[model samples]
Target chain A: MKEGRETTGGIEYVVGAEKGIREIVRDEDVMPLLESALSAGASRVEVTDSRGGTLWACGASSGNNDSATVERRPVFLEGEPAGSLVVEASPGSQLRLNDLAGLLCAALNKIITNSLKRMLTTEIHTSVVNRTYEELLETNKRLRASESRYRELAENLDRKVQERTEELKRMHTRLIQQEKAASIGLLAAGVAHEINNPIGFISSNLNTLKRYISRFTEMMDFYRAAIEEADKAGGGITEAACRKWSDLKLDFIVRDVEELISQSLDGAERVRKIVSDLKGFSHVDDSKEDIVDLNTEIERTFNVLVHEIPEDAEIVKEFGSLPGFLCNPAMICQVFLNIILNSLQARRQGLKLHVSTKHVDGNITVAFSDNGPGIPEEVRNRIFEPFFTTKDVGAGTGLGLTVTLDIVTAYGGDIEVTSCPGKGTTFVIRLPAERREHVKVR
Target chain B: MIEFDRTEKRMVLKLVFYGPALSGKTTNLLRLHDLLSREGRGELMVLDTRDDRTIFFDLLPFFLVTPGGLKIKVKVYTVPGQVKHDATRKAVLQRADGVAFIADSRVSEVANNYSSFENLEKNLAFVGIDIERIPLVIQFNKRDLSDIVPEADIERVWRPTGIPVFMASALEGWGVVETFSRLVELTYDSIDGKCGLSEGYGLDREDFVGRLTKRVQGS
Candidate 1:
């Protein structure tokens, strides 16, 4: 890769000694040396100077013979010019005194040129090495900066990954808790209905037994009055009291007792109807899909939680005429139960829970709202996040809204919450009106 | 390592004045332009500027003819001292035979001086001029300013480099000629070796120096 060339020229050096010689000798010496050598027909000339014991020589010769031999000898500087040289002559040789001077000039020029070349080459080589070293230093600096940047990016990435992993762990824990709470809700609804059934019949049987005791007591009172009148009439009246008791139809009274028992049996049948209605309200069978009435589920959740709400709180329901929705009835019911219970818990005092359902835009929109201290601005955005709750730590698990959101999303629905700090909070849940075939499998 | 030809026997030597921002590179050129004999030198040509600042460069051309008929023309150039004008600096440094680095001597400017020196080295390489091969002289300028950097520290740093160093206040016109003379001597020796000016052209070193010095002082 030869790229370019560099050339230089200038005046740089001085020859000949001027210190111990007269100015005229120093100036006149070179001219005579040239003239004497030319007059000798040698076609060449030489000069030597010895000052401060330093040997300096100038020599010149001319020749045309390609292989001409020339003598080589040492030149000495003294009172007289002393230097040795040989000249070769042949036909057509263009050798002259002036030519000798030119040749000497050329030889001396070679010496100076060679010396300068060595110096410039050395300098150029050193400069190139220095430049290369400086470039290497710059490159090394850039590489170190790049390495540090990559290290910082890697550290930031690792920290972000760790934060995301922790978030995933919390979500997993919330999912487990939601599943447990859903199961518990199903159990409570079923047990409440089961206990209602036995109590209904036992109360009805006790009421029938009281009515029979009253009728038998009236008949005994009539017999006691007739026996007292006969005893007052005389000694022979005992037979008349016995006849009066017979006339009062004691046999008929025994037949009437059997009729009373039959009536009590009818009343017990009415009690059975009430118990069956209670069972219908609490559907506990956990299956993939079930046809459920939205209105009925809302009513049942309200009934179950009515006693738990504060006394000052009011519950309002606005139910629409909606067709039965095919869904995972247990899960849907659990979602309603959790939301309503959460509303009750959020109430401070004088709370109002308004639950409204409507069919609109091919979906059933169930809106549950409460008038209480609404969710604060800071925590409102995170209401559906697991473990984010305003309730006291042990009293509420904070998974209620999170589970509600998950169930709604799983059903291809959405739930939105709106709250104003001093006003109230409202949650709107939208579920698909028509069940899709794919939803039944999962 | 940069080269030019003188086909007409009139060779021009290029010397560059380079340094950090506000280090008086332009001031040195101005002083030389003002003091040198007008008859022996061309008019100082300053390439356009912005707000009296040398944005490109300043040039002062001079001519010296030896008794033996060798004509030597020396061109002195001063690069813009602003750090961002590196392209201009590099352009001016091309074919440079010698350099004078005008460093700022204020105590706060020590780092700037080093950075500028490094920049000079880079620019020189870009122009294909080997920094070590080209005769280099360090000129610490702005000595008139109080709180100047310590002289000992500057000497200690530059001594090992083996290049001539001089303290100057270009504003006061002190030590400027000494700095210029040192570069001239180095430049002459370097170019002489290459051209065989003394042996081939019969141009002696004393005659050349005497003429250059007389031209510089006669202005």
Candidate 2:
């Protein structure tokens, strides 16, 4: 397959590198020609190469010694002396012997040249075939190596895509949690107010109780002083002691003290309730699950958001009996909280939040409806999209509805929003009654 | 380049028609055989299956003798375009001086076209041919069919490569000669640059192109 080499008529003719002499001019072919020449009056004949390698001998050349060799002809192949033939005959037959030698030499030259040509062609053909086969093998090996590399890449591509998708999902969940935490941080003031009210009254009630104890101590001190004085005067009651006891108003003090103690206990209980509600709202271990009542989660959300809600707005809960379903309670609480907050924020006053839960047809539907200005038709569809907000920037993080949708869908539930302009907005969420152990939504 | 026998005053140049399966690589050669005159061309030898698919290759020999008696012979070959015939393809593409890449024009075959082109590049590199140096012509064949890729889109995609692009329906005999002639011209110029075809052998580019692209006397 190289260039600049001679291949005229598809043969690479070589010179002077004869492989086998006997293979070119066989003795059998030369002997027949020689015998015919002898019959035509030739005495003897023999053929040999330039190096004296014999190809054929007959008649006198066979050592009969009957005739002297008088004539000789050189065989030429491609203008090169390959061999020569000699003929022995009588003087009268020398001309015929010369002609016979020429004819035999010519025949021998044609045979040798044709044989060499055939050999060259065969050699070129074998070389070409062998080289092509070798190249094909080398090419096949390289192709197989490249093919396996591509196959490995293709196989790993699927796995890489899956792993990346899983990683992105984890990152998205983490981002949502961070956003939720930030929003809660912004609402800390309202939470502080909720806890502070009960604590404030509890501390005031304890002060009042302390003053009542002081009054009792003073009365006891006066009574002891009067008794001691009476003993000194032969155990008699005096006008000064009677005046002091009357001034004390002991009956009124006992009644007021009992009331003060009861009020203080109630304030303490209120403070404990607020703290418990806050603890439940900040459920950080959302991966864990328990058999939860959706209605209970909603009520807890209401408790946590009590101070955040406007004073005029009323929350009406129409709870229906439902069987407990297994779920991550914290996530459900977040969803309920988002919905309730949206309802409470719909109006500054005269906001009626209607929350209802019902179990029917193996599905539980929790609907939160508010009688306030409804979501616009254009914005209604995009409400659940991440980072979609209707509230002013600092008031809402825009992840509330998106996170709600994610949690609900992850639990094999779906949420739908129906809002009519100037009427109200209702968010209806449906969940499967049966527990699904491993449900992946979206 | 296949063989340049200086002693014989003969240069055997090789050109290959490559593409995805059923994109009509063989049909391009057949069309060229039909269009070109017999004075400088040989018989088209096709090694095909009974189903009309190329099994090994197709060879179409072309010849050109310059005024100075310099003989230039071009052997045109088409490899089996099926994906499983990679070995046959590599063997056929051993030393190609030029190539014509025929592609399916159907919109649905975009992926197949890209994949086949990548395969061609890989195989060409394996055979030790530099794709950037070798003269290449692209043919968006099967333009006669419906739902074909738009010519404008083809231009937009292939224009930056600076390779000549042809849209042809080989079966209908349109754009085939143009593609063949352009490829022959490019191949001649490239070889001329490398080995001095005109300066050393008096092989003029136009004369060679004219001889090969000459229309047949009858059909």
Candidate 3:
């Protein structure tokens, strides 16, 4: 399709879609070219559309005369003709014209060229400004949307943060519960055996007392028979009754029955006390604030862990003048249980735990120092972290010291650990006696 | 790559010289208008200006007609480099066949050069042209001046980008022809391989570039 059309070439390029001659060429721009051409000695000059519609004309019209000369040159844009410039004059004026039509058409073409270029430049500049403005509008809309979203998040921040903190506190309690369940379950295994001993001795004492009662009844019947016989034969039957009473062993039965009854009561009381210890330890989860004796709590914890304590293990209690501390009795006992259990498991043989409690400077101080294979520096530092265990996989839940730390801190207290690695490890726990509340966990 | 009317035997290709203010874009066009033979080119038209600064643009047209009478016209343009003239820049940048980025080489104009490059990239996209695939060259102009970025440092930084870069003192007419020759050659290749001009007519690469750069053919 390479049709050879000579090009005058373009000085300006169009950015968007091209505009037609009718759209680009304005009335005001063409009037001057026509007037200028007419002033240059042409009888008539006219601009025509591609379809030969006259858009502008100047000077008188040339009639249908045979000698009239009509000079027409196409008005071009980008080498494509959009319209034509026609210059008309009488025959005698043609030579005097000196190709005046040519010169004027060139002038008209230049005007069209400059006009089209201005139109294109202006059109494209307008398009760019409009597009940029639209883009700015869209960007402003997005910025406003983002601002409101961030503002909403900021408004809800504090309440949401507090909610999360409370949730974490509840989770922490559950973790301590799970860990405490392990130790409590172990101690419960000892409870039945602990109660079974008193039950056995009490039943034996009751049976012995029953046999003594029967022998006394038999002696009484013999005495009644002897008395009846004596009425009939005075002094003769009295010897048989005395013989029967001697065989019955009446004096020993009376003394031994009293002792057996007292001993049986003691055995029942021992069984009752064991049941109460079981109840106290089992209810730790629901433990509430109360007047607490921390020393009593330590002793009770040892009693509950009686089955796990080795026979040769020694516990030295250095009792100090500790006043009654207001705290949760069951929860405090759990704290004591965790620490004492650590001392118990530290060594099996020659395990010596020194536990002491005292009141000092408006605070209660409780310490348990164990003379076992002492904690290593690294292990001691991490012991209070939950699930950090030195014991074998199933042998430890690893939350023992963590629970102890949580409980102590909940009572407005703190715990400190010191270890020499080989000699022993000591844990010092301090609880403020007054001017304190449960510390909020962040 | 605007007009490719095969039936009309005319192909109009556009090239734009883009850069920061006073970075020698118009200078490159002026030098090219001077050096390129007038036989293949039309008159150079420089539009509105105030105080010798280009407010609109500068345009020069060059056409090459083959033996078969197929006319391939290359129109080179330079956009006004002032930041206030961004709209005009975007308008002139539309449908560009190739681009030569003329950057100021002065140490103080480094940030201005970078921002103008970004402006080029953004406006190219606005005109629906992809900067990645366009045949583009970078000319660090004003290299004769002291305190310009050293050529070694420029190469070290720009070599990895794979875009061809040139050093020039455009005011003194040092590297203008070389930069233009490379851009025109790249544009010819791109049209042949990617822009679908090869399907219409096979372009004579050596003759086309040799004629534009005023070099002997077959060199």
Q: What docking tier does model 1 reach?
A: incorrect
Q: Give all candidates' CA lDDT scores.
A: 0.66, 0.78, 0.79
Tell me the DockQ of each model, to 2 decimals: 0.05, 0.07, 0.20
Worst 10 residues of 2 chain A by lDDT: A9-18
- The list of candidate 2 runs beyond 4 A from truth reads A1-107, A208-260, A435-437, A440-442, B1-219
Q: Which has the better lDDT: candidate 2, or candidate 3?
A: 3
Name the runs in model 1 displaced over 4 angstroms: A1-94, A107-318, A321-331, A343-354, A369-393, A405-426, A431-442, B1-114, B118-138, B141-165, B168-219
Cα lDDT of model 3 by residue, B175-210, tens digit: 998999999999988877753444445557887787
Worst 10 residues of 3 chain A by lDDT: A2-11
Candidate 1 chain A — worst ten consecutive residues by lDDT sum?
A: A10-19
Q: Could you give candidate 2's per-residue lDDT for residues A47-155 as a string of tens digits?
A: 7777777678777644333434466778754334556777777554544555676777777766666665565445434544655676678789999999999999998
Q: On a 0 to 1 DockQ scale, where is model 3?
A: 0.20
What DockQ does candidate 1 score?
0.05
Tens digit of per-residue lDDT, candidate 3, span A285-403 = 44656676778777888888888789999989998978888877777888888888888888899999999988898988999999877888767679988899999999888888888
List pairs with backbone clashes in candidate 3.
none
Task: Please state the i-RMS of candidate 2.
Answer: 12.5
Per-model chain A TM: 0.45, 0.75, 0.68
Per-residue lDDT over B31-144 for candidate 2, one digit per residue giving the tens place of the 0 to 100 score: 999998877776676643548998667777787777767777787888778887765676667678899999999999899889999999997887778999999999999999
Q: How high is the DockQ of candidate 2?
A: 0.07
Worst 10 residues of 3 chain B by lDDT: B194-203
Pairs of residues clashing in candidate 1: none
